[model samples]
Target: MDHDHDFEWRPGETLEVDGEAARTEASWFREVLGRYASGVTVVTTMTGTASGESPIGMTCQSFTSVSLDPPLVAFLPTRQSRAYAAIRRSGTFCVNLLAADQADVSDRMAGPSDDKFAGLAWHPAPGTGAPILDGVVGYVDCTVEAIHEAGDHVIVVGRVVDLATGEDTKPLVYHRGDYTTTG
Candidate 1:
């Protein structure tokens, strides 16, 4: 068989190797990605619990626009998160881009606490039906189209149903495990 091993340190090393390779690929990736800036978002869905049935939302930095014509967006949620499970079951959600001053809200929602939504003012978005948070940068409601399993996270693809941008929008940023704001 023919092969190209341009990037390989030792082209035929694999044939002679017997033990596990010592490397920190995951940590390296995390460190590299920390240098890049990303906007913060809240992915919200209705929790099918016994309580009053309010929208369940979580603060996330993994969200982005996918398409324009059909209107799409994508986000990755950690596979182990309870919020991810509920959102997956509901099959609908909202992506709320946070404003600069909304860091407190984001921090609160990202915790493991049970009552994250309490005292937070929210209004239901029309069409696909996801709650939109006030004092945020913008919002987009979506219906789950496909959820592809990635390594430790699941890539959620959603078809956008509605969208709205606030008048005073300031993007909240995340970098190196720290929150930032657009200056």
Candidate 2:
């Protein structure tokens, strides 16, 4: 298969691959890597204060700190995520590190709901004005620095403008398809 073109695989949908090699490899790769534990975050952005505009966000496990001096952070959002499209348009975002008690928030953001912020208490991060969820363990407010394409996701690098620790609580973690917290 040619690697020049793009490929996409959606959940519950089958791809018409030339052979099972690609499919099998994808499944095996996911299974093997699922064992590595990671903290969860909700990457959020607000496009505008217009009548119909609302905060957009998605729960992400692929978030990490990328630099310190010129402070940078990165998060991977699927290419097809509407939330990501909003983030790109806004050119700024907030990464809310979830607290262990906020699993419901994670599930809500991860779903296909049109309004993920419904019934959730949150305030805007001062730097970017993106929603900083109320019970998050911490948050990083940033402006988009760069974007790159990955397999099914796009890597977003943000230049940190502001940050702060929120409630003193254990971080929400995901591992092997389950939610857990550290001691």
Candidate 3:
């Protein structure tokens, strides 16, 4: 059974959901999606090496596993993120899945501070050299596989190079604009 055209749609054809416009107002979109809970992560990377090397990181909730056969993962980062710019330059990143008790760490990485890593305990991921933040639930170290434009964010596909889980811990979560955690 050839499924080549299973999802094909003609140009100029609009997609509708229950007669509602597929393109909703940005505020409404965000408001509705806010109801969904998501796990938190700090995406980290290193730029340069030795003496001048610096760590870059930003709190992210848009992360997911994309594949298993070849080991791939993805995260969406805003185009204007300074840390993302450095990650793009370095061509590698580590996604540190925040533990429930790491809300402070998340706040630190999410801010506009010049040094997000200040006072943070972490070590370099052996495969990518990206920071593996201490106390995280888990981490995924990867080399950038591909980047695709997605509205104001970029869909970054990373080929997993190394990954591991930390001590069993509940994950940090975000829902309706507040921090939460699994039971």
Candidate 4:
């Protein structure tokens, strides 16, 4: 017979909140969180092209290094993306941090269509045999450690197998859905 609002659970359902509350809270949280600034990246993987020639495949943002001892990196791909599926099935990828001047490359990889790696300067990274961006601030080549679902995205954890560092490049940042560059 307790009518307390904090009943430890919703009075009559599995969800703690109703639909209206979910939308309201989600929108509020999204707006608050979108204010955070984050670096941009063009994560890539090697694949066979239409001519059966090898090429690097790419997608923008969503890259991070999670651990150093085991040398693990993490990146997320919105689960709905075709490239996400491809990267998952391919079982390997490289994280390429974008230089401030490489915003165009980042945007190009963000798309779902067209060839992404064409003319992208790169060389074979050992272990994964993936293409690491030639001008990136740094690159981490890894094999996936784990894949889990988070919100609307798939959390990908990669165990670093090899790494390379490029010449000093100012990091490209993204905030409020806009690119920011400052030297």
The runs of at least 3 residues in candidate 3 whose Cα sits more than 4 Å from the true structure, single-residue gaps closed, are 1-24, 49-51
Local error of candidate 4 at 176, Å?
Answer: 1.8
Report the lDDT tens digits of candidate 3 across residue range 1-183: 222222101111112222223333433665688888999999999987567998989888899999998999999887778888989999999999999999898888877788778888999999989999999889999999999999757999999999999969899998877899989
lDDT of each: 0.76, 0.84, 0.83, 0.69
| TM-score, model 3 to reference | 0.84
lDDT of 4: 0.69
Ranking 3 against 4 by lDDT, winner? 3
Model 3 lDDT vs. the true structure?
0.83
Best by TM-score: 2
Cα-based RMSD of the predictions, in order?
Answer: 9.4, 4.1, 10.0, 9.0
Evaluate residue 145 in candidate 4 and report its C-alpha lDDT on the 0 to 100 scale: 91
User: TM-scores of all models?
Assistant: 0.83, 0.87, 0.84, 0.77
Candidate 4's TM-score reads 0.77
Per residue, candidate 1 scores C-alpha lDDT tens digits across 78-97 of 77677788889888999999
Ranking by lDDT: 2, 3, 1, 4
Q: Which of the predicted structures, 3 or 4, would earn the higher TM-score when compared with the native?
A: 3
